[model samples]
Each structure stands twice: as C-alpha cells, then as structure tokens.
Target chain A: MIQAALTFAVTCFALALVFNLWHLARAPGVVDRILALDTMVINAIALLNLYGISQGTPVYFEVSMLIAMVGFVSTVAYCRFILRGNIIE
Target chain B: MLEDTTLIAEIVVSVLLVVAGVFGLVGSLGLVKLDDTMRRLHAPTKATTLGIGGVLIASMIYSAVFLDRLSFHELLITVFLFLTAPITANFIAKSYMHRHVDEGDLPPTEGPYGWAVYDAVPEDERPIDTK
Candidate 1:
C-alpha cells in the first residue's frame, strides 16, 4: 500500500512540475512567471518529502526545510524588486 | 498484533500521501488555468501549502511507525511553511498591484494615507486630519 501510494504521489507531483514549467514558459506577465516559479519550488519540496518517506529516511527533511526557506526568501526578494525597482532599500 | 498495527499505519500514511498529491496537482492546475493574475495567485498559496503540510504529516507518521524513531523535524518545516506562505503571497500580490493595478481602481482606504505601496509621504510629515 505504501509503495503504491508513493508511486501515485510521485507521478502527480511530476505532472505538477510539468504544468508549472508550462506556465513559466508562456506566462502572460512577469508576475505570472514568478508565481509559476514559486509554485515549482513548492512542488519540488513536496517531491523531496515524498521521496524521503519512500526511502524511509529523515535526511530529506532538513533538505526540504532549507529549500522552503530559500524559496520563500527568493520569492519575497523578487516581489520586492518588482515593487521598488530594487531588492534592498 | 504487531502486523495489524503496521498495516493500519501504512494505510493511514498512504491515504495522507495520496491526498497531498491530489492537492498539489490541483494547485498547479489552478496556477495554469486561472485567467487573472490575482486569481492565479490564489491557487498555489492556499492549496500547495496544505499539500505540503499533508506530506510532512505523513512523513512524521511514516518515520514513527516504520523507522521506529519519533521525528519532530518535519513539524519545523510545516510551521515555517505556514508562516512564510502568507507573507510570500502578500509580497507577490503587492508586486502585482504595483505593476498592474492603478490607484484609481482601488477603493479608498479608511485611513487618511494612501496605500502603503503607493504612499509618498514620510511617516511624520503627512497631515493628521481625522476625517
């Protein structure tokens, strides 16, 4: 059961990553592209967590947490740049 | 008895994983399909946050039941995600508004000052009219 669930989840997130890439490639606006990228980061985190569960290890937990922090900071920096024309005041 | 307990744990973890994946797919789908920028922003923030939360919860359970060591590390990721997702969304929305939305299109703030993104006055220099 766990193996089947892992396969199903991996497939779903892989599809999601594809969708995010599609959106990123042809996004109508810069904000749309940024949003797509942000979603991709989130999907990647989910993928990492699922892989950790399947492998029965806790190592990926720290990796995913780091990715989450970096992703959030990058997204915020991108937004700040767009808002103020620079990332830092 | 031990086999039954392990089987139940597997079932619980499997359900959680499946549900999380579905949420993740739907959130990405919404990101692609939603027509408006603001509307598009709505999809990933709420749905993917929950999706990741579910996965983390499942990971915690799996580690406890299968690996035989209780893990609290996933909780930190979950909490960090919940705290940051909203702030990230807000910044994104602010940036989108800065780029696409006009001051005229927004309803006036009840406060005397304009929206923070657009307000030009320094903190102490603005007028203090009450009404």
Candidate 2:
C-alpha cells in the first residue's frame, strides 16, 4: 500500500514540477520567478521525502533539511536585493 | 507477514503521502495559474509548506514503524518550514510592493513615516508624484 502511494506521490511531484517550470519560464516579473523557484524547492523537498520512504532510508531527511535552509535563505536574499537594490545593504 | 499494526502503519503512511502530493501539486498549480504576483505569492508559502509537512509526517511514521526507532529529526523540517514560510511570504510581498506595486494598491501607512519600505529614504527624497 505504501509503495502504491509512493508511486502516486511521484506522479504528483512530476505534475508539480511541470507547473513550477511553466511559471519559471513565463513569469511576468523577477519576483514571480523567484516565487516559482521557491515553490520548486518545496516540491523538491517533498520528492526527496518520498524517495527516502520508498528506499527505507533515513539519510535523505537531512538532505531535505538542507534544501529547506537554502530555499528560505535564497528567497529572503532575492527579495532583499530586489527591495533594497542591494542584497548586502 | 505483515502484522495488523504494521498494516495500519502502512495505511497511515499511504494517506500522508497522497495528501502531501496533492497539496504540493495544488500549490504549484497556483503558481502557474494565478493571474498576478501577489496572488501567486499566496500559493507555495501556505499550501506547499503544508504539503511538505504531510510528507515529513509520513517519513516519521516510516522511521518509527519500519526502522524500529523513534525519530524526532523529521519534525525539525516541519518546525523550520513553519518558522520560515511566513517570513518568506512577508519578504516577497514587501519586495513586490517596493518594486512595482501601484501606490494605490498599498494600504495607508499607519504612522507619520511612510510605509516601512519608504522609511529608508528621507521624505524629501521621494518623488512628489509617488504618494
């Protein structure tokens, strides 16, 4: 049952990827693109979690954590740069 | 042979995975299908984070039932996500408003100082046409 669910989850992730990519490719503004990228990272985290369960391994959980950190920091940095016209400022 | 308890665990994991996937997909679809930036901003921060939460719960269940050890580490992802999703949403909203959102769309600033985004500049620095 769990295996079946994992397969479904993978399919859903593929659909989500397509959506994220579509948004990324045609985003009306830089901020929209950044939003799409952020969503993509979240989707990637879900995929990694599913993969971890399918393989019965715990190691991927750490990978998911790192991705979350990167996604959050990058989003904030991108927004900061756009807002202030300089990231470090 | 799967014990009844094991079967129940599998059921729970299955549900979590499906729910996570659906919500994640909906969130991404919102990103693509929404008409504008602010509307698009609403999608992933809320729905996608919840989706990931479901997946993390599934992972926790898998680790506990199959790996035979209780693991709280998966909860770290949940906690981190909850903490940061709103922060990202706020930053993105501010960036958009600061960059291109119409001044009319912006709410009245609550204080004598203009909006937070405008405070960095002296009131004299703003173009007379901006407000």
Candidate 3:
C-alpha cells in the first residue's frame, strides 16, 4: 500500500512539474512566469520529501528546507525588483 | 497489536500522500488554466501550500511510526513555509499591481495614507540631500 501510494504521488508531482514548465514557457506576463517558477520550486520540495519518505531516510529534510528558504527569498527579490526597480535600497 | 498498528500507519501515510499529490496537481493545473493573472495568483499560494503541508505531516507520522524515531525537523519546514508563503504572495501581488494595475482602478483606502506602492512622501518629509 505504501509503495503504491509513493509511486502515485511521485507521478502526480512529476506531472505537476511538467505543467509548471508549460506555464513558464508560455506565460503571458513576467509575473506569471515568476509565479510558475515559484510553484515549480514548491513542487520540487514536495518531490524531495516524498522521495525521502519512500526511502525511509531523513536525509532530504535539510535539503528541502534550504530549497524552501532560497525559493522564497528569490521570489521576494524578483518581486521587489519589479516593484521598486531595485532589490536592495 | 504491532501488526495492526503498522497497517494503520501505512494506510494513514498513504492517504496523506495521495491527498498531497492531488492538491499539488490541481494547484499547478490552476496555474496553467486560469485566465487572469490575479486569479492565477490565487491557485499556488493556497493549494500548493496545503499540498506541501500534507507531505510534511505524512513524513512526520511515517518517521514516528515506522522508523521508530520522532522527527521534528519537518515541523520547522512547515512553520517556515507557513510564515513565508503569505509574504511571498504579498510581494508577488504588489509587484503585479505595480506593473499591471492602475491606481485609479482601486477603491480609495479612506485613510490619510495611500497605497504603499504608490504613496508619495510630502515635501517636508523628503530626505535632505547631502550631495
């Protein structure tokens, strides 16, 4: 049961990654592209977590955490650049 | 008793994983299919966050039950994500507003201050130029 669930989830999130890439490639606006990229980061984090669970190891925990932090910071920075014309003032 | 508990644990974790995947897929689908930018913004912030939360919770439960150890690190990620998700969304919205939204389109704030992105400093409050 656990194995089946893991495989199902891994496939779903992988499909989600593809959807996000499609959005990124043909996004109508810059903000939409950024949003797609942000979502991709999130999906990647989910994928990492699922892999860790299936493997029964805690090794991916810190990696996901770091990716989450970096993704948030980058998203905010991109938005800041668009809003203020500079990332840091 | 031990066998039953293990079965229950596996079942619970499986359900959570499946739920997370569904939410994740739906959220990304929304991102692609939504017609409006603001509407698209609504999708990932809420649904995707829940998806990530589900996976994290499942991880915690799986670790506690199957691995015979309690893991709290996933909780840190959960908390950090909850804290940052809103801020990220806010920044993205603000940027969107800055680029695409017209100040005239929004209803007035009914306060002395204007929207933060568009508000201007009064002459008296301007920083003194030293150069």
- The most accurate candidate by lDDT is 3
lDDT tens digits, residue span B1-131, model 3: 99999999999999999999999999999999989999999999889999999999999999999899898999999899989889988988988899999999999989767888899756565568634
The residue-by-residue lDDT of candidate 3 on A1-89, one tens digit each, is 98898898899899999999999999999999889999999999999999999888998999999999999999999999898889898
Question: Candidate 1 on B99-122: residue-level lDDT in tens?
Answer: 999999999989767898898766
- Residues B1-131, model 2: lDDT tens digits: 56988989989999999998899989988888888888888888898889889999998998899889789878999999999999999998898888786777768887556677766656676657564
What is the lDDT, from 0 to 100, of the residue A11 in candidate 1?
93
Model 1: per-residue Cα lDDT over A60-84, one tens digit each = 9899989998999899999888888
Q: On a 0 to 100 scale, what is the lDDT of residue B110 in model 3?
A: 90
Candidate 1 chain A, run of 10 with poorest lDDT: A50-59
Choose 1 or 2, whichever is better by TM-score.
1
Worst 10 residues of 2 chain B by lDDT: B118-127
Q: Which candidate gets the maximum DockQ versus the true structure? A: 1
Clashes of each: 0, 0, 0
Q: Which stretches of candidate 3 lie over 4 Å from their true place?
A: B121-131
| TM values, all candidates | 0.95, 0.90, 0.94
For residues A1-89, what per-residue lDDT tens digits would candidate 2 score against the true structure? 88889999889988998999988998888888888888888889889988888888889989999999999999999999888778894
Superposed model 2: Cα runs more than 4 Å off: B121-131
